[model samples]
Target: MEPFMSDLSALSSALAATAAAAAPSLVSVHSHRSRASGFVWKSDLVVTADEALADEGEVIIAFADGTTRPATIAGRDHTTDVALLRFDGRDVSSTPLARDVPPLGSLAIIVAADQGTPVAALAMVSKSAGPWRSLRGGDIDARIELDTGLRRSSEGSLVLDASGRAVGMAVRGPGRTLVIPAATIERVASKLETHGRIARGYLGAGLQPVKLDEGVGAMVMSLDKNGPAAAAGLRQGDVITALNNAPFSSMRGLMRELGPDSVGAVVDVAALRGGEPMRVALTIGERPA
Candidate 1:
């Protein structure tokens, strides 16, 4: 039997209210710079690039009421892939956290679009939620092992959970799609509102995850203009250990500790370069766009 039209309208309104309550409100990010890369969105505290370090900038924010505000660059957290943007002491609405963020291995739905057409995908968490890559735009984020969320024209968009809560944001593309974890929003909300910046240490170098197939160590990837590794005399085939004398287990760990602020601060780097145990000093620099 056909459903009642009034009942359907009521259901839609109820669902919208529930979603409006559950989903974190989004700040539509717009760029005025001609050379700017793409549009960006902010959920008050969280940005689209909280997955992979290296996203930043100033943006104009659009509120639900048609009011607009210019957002200034606070700082970018490469390790956490979170960029902190700020307005003044003025009040602004943000996407509210509904319930708790999902645990790792839970399911989510990513929605994106090109031009104005909307698209979506279903995915499972690769891990409980660590540093994510929000710059890559593609159908699968290899690092996170999700099935959907890459779009050619969906940068600066929101990724919502099934209940209609925003789980992440859209970013750059071509390969593994990038997104921010909802939990990150929890960590940075307060800072975004107050300071408009997040403090992090810097090291000038390029790095990528390495895998040992058998015994011989090799380089998997490199960074732009020689990354922190290059500046620190780090080379390919180097087995990494600690940053700033802190024991690190993975790339994510290294990033988490790199809350760089000073451009010339010396960071302690421990790695097994060329199979020989070694230590080096890395000079951190302000991140580039």
Candidate 2:
């Protein structure tokens, strides 16, 4: 009994220490639409959930010290659900983004602020997997789900690993808690810092992955009326086998090829129509903001 009690005490102390160490970087993000949380990055940048800023009116960054500053949206990417806001607060202590995710069932600490004081929740890394896309089209390097069942206010909370390094940002999900992995955060943040938005190519078609004899390809589930695919004479039920002669395995694979750089570029689409092979040339379009 004594040994178990001692272990529990030590774990509590460690979590408290980690929360304290991460306090300075955690912030409460208040927008016209809702209030959430975020963390300082670099000196002038703050990262938060993009959905928190979707209303996009006046935004305020509130610290545990009771200080507040106005922030301007530097950039936002809906796909990754990350938004970068510019706030040049003096002597800002930023959290370092961890390069790798901890193993599943490891302790994950979620930190936020209450009246300028750090509050935290200890949870396990419930789920972690390799590169995947969100239903909304974010191409994330990994998926991390926490077992905290955190509140909506936990949105944008900084999720830290055992070493107190930030591993992800918490976001509200349907009946669950999700943390956008650190690698995805860093990648999207850098792009947002430079481009103000993620550059995504648009084929203007709804697609699903279909198994093929050689590999996999995206089957056109539907096409936007008069959109790129339609303009290129593509139709519903077309199994697109490849793009630019490269194998297209899934909808995400097709999306990867349709990056912002591919917009306005003409590409060859290899497809199967009525069990017959054919190819079509079409120009990719820029995704509407």
Q: Candidate 1, TM-score vs. the true structure?
A: 0.47
Candidate 1 residue spans exceeding 4 A from truth: 2-24, 32-58, 88-92, 98-146, 152-156, 170-178, 189-289
Clashing pairs in model 2, backbone N/Cα/C closer than 3 A: 64-116
> Which whole-number lDDT from 0 to 100 does residue 61 have in model 1?
50
lDDT of 2 by residue, 160-232 (tens): 9988888889897777788888888998999889888887888889988889888887888988886799899
How many clashes in each candidate? 25, 1
What lDDT does candidate 2 reach at residue 200? 82
Off by over 4 Å in 2: 114-117, 204-266, 269-279
TM match of model 2 to true structure: 0.78
Where does candidate 2 have its weakest 10-residue lDDT segment?
252-261
lDDT of each: 0.49, 0.84
Would you give me the overall lDDT of model 1?
A: 0.49
- Residue 267 local lDDT, model 1: 70
